[model samples]
Target: MNDQMKVRFFKEARSEENFVEEMCNFRCQVRSDLEERSRLMSEIARRAPDEAGARYLDTLIDRQKRDEHKLVLLKELLFLARVETHERKLDKLDDN
Candidate 1:
């Protein structure tokens, strides 16, 4: 490959790697956040008065749902990254 082609290929690969790494990091963060939220919910359930507990639980539940949605999106991103990586490998092979 010419210098320009090489540079383009390197940049693409670097960007893809960065995206995959970011998705992985996001997944880890979401998992950690969910765990902490769960712990807090449990603590509130144990200690709060019935009405207060109900309100807190509702808020936590909403947050949990949002986190779950974000997790799904992150999983989709990881899947897309895998697909892109495979396609890139195939293209490389075709070029050879």
Candidate 2:
């Protein structure tokens, strides 16, 4: 390919990698935030003045756990996609 095309492709690849890395970082932060929230909620539930308040906190914690699970799945999918992208790029290089 032409020099300009190669440069453009390189830029695009770099941008995509950056985007994926950013997403991974953001997800990690969100997961950490959720963990902290759950921990705080658990502490509050333990010292809760009423049963109802504890139950409510339990529900919130469950929701956060579910959200965290979904986020983990998405992170795994993103990691696989990145690996596949690299594999394809390597294949192309081999072809050339």
Candidate 3:
């Protein structure tokens, strides 16, 4: 590979790894948030007004859904990056 391609490949690999790490961190945060929300919901259900508790639960659900969507997008991006890297390596071989 040319120097430029090599630099690009390293950059992309680093970026992909960083994204995957972020995705993992987000997943862990979501799990923790879900656990905390569940506890809050239980408490709210027992002591808070029905409407208020429901509204809070709905907001939590919405946030969870958004996080899930972001995780999926990041996974797809990582897959694409791996595929591109593989293709580039194959191209190099073909040239030789």
Candidate 4:
């Protein structure tokens, strides 16, 4: 939730065809984050349950897994949208 590693939705292009590029960058960042979270979750899960008792760690791990799933879906959708955007531009040129 902090300024660090926040995802931004570009409602409009940043003046050119860079919006797709921006989305790609966002997807990459999200992918990296997902990998790191999974790794950390794995490391934590390796510990004995008694050590991480009270269910706090379990709750956090579950939340991270859910977040990782969401990011995977989001990145796929972004890629699809970018492809469609490119195809539209090509179609416009064909129509002209």
> For residues 1-96, what per-residue lDDT tens digits would candidate 1 score against the true structure?
135433543454567867677668868998899999999999998889599799989999999998887777668767877799889879999999
Per-candidate TM-score against the hidden true structure: 0.78, 0.63, 0.50, 0.59
Give the per-residue lDDT digits (tens) of candidate 3, residues 2-89: 3543354456466655644554564567567767766776787778768877898788778767656654554565566657757777
Give model 4 RMSD, 1 decimal: 4.4
In model 4, which range of ten residues has the least summed lDDT?
Answer: 1-10
Clash counts for all predictions: 0, 0, 0, 0
List candidate 1 stretches off by more than 4 Å: 1-14
Q: Spell out the clash pairs found in candidate 2.
A: none
Residue 45's lDDT within candidate 2 is: 76
Better of 2 and 3 by TM-score: 2
Judged by whole-model lDDT over C-alpha atoms, candidate 3 comes out at: 0.63
How well does candidate 1 score on lDDT at residue 83?
92
Q: Say which candidate scores most in TM-score.
A: 1
Top-down TM-score ranking: 1, 2, 4, 3
Order the candidates by lDDT, highest first.
Answer: 1, 2, 4, 3
How high is the CA lDDT of each candidate model?
0.78, 0.69, 0.63, 0.64
Number of the candidate with higher TM-score, 1 or 2:
1
- Residue-level lDDT of model 4, residues 19-52, one tens digit each, is 6677677667767876786776666667645655
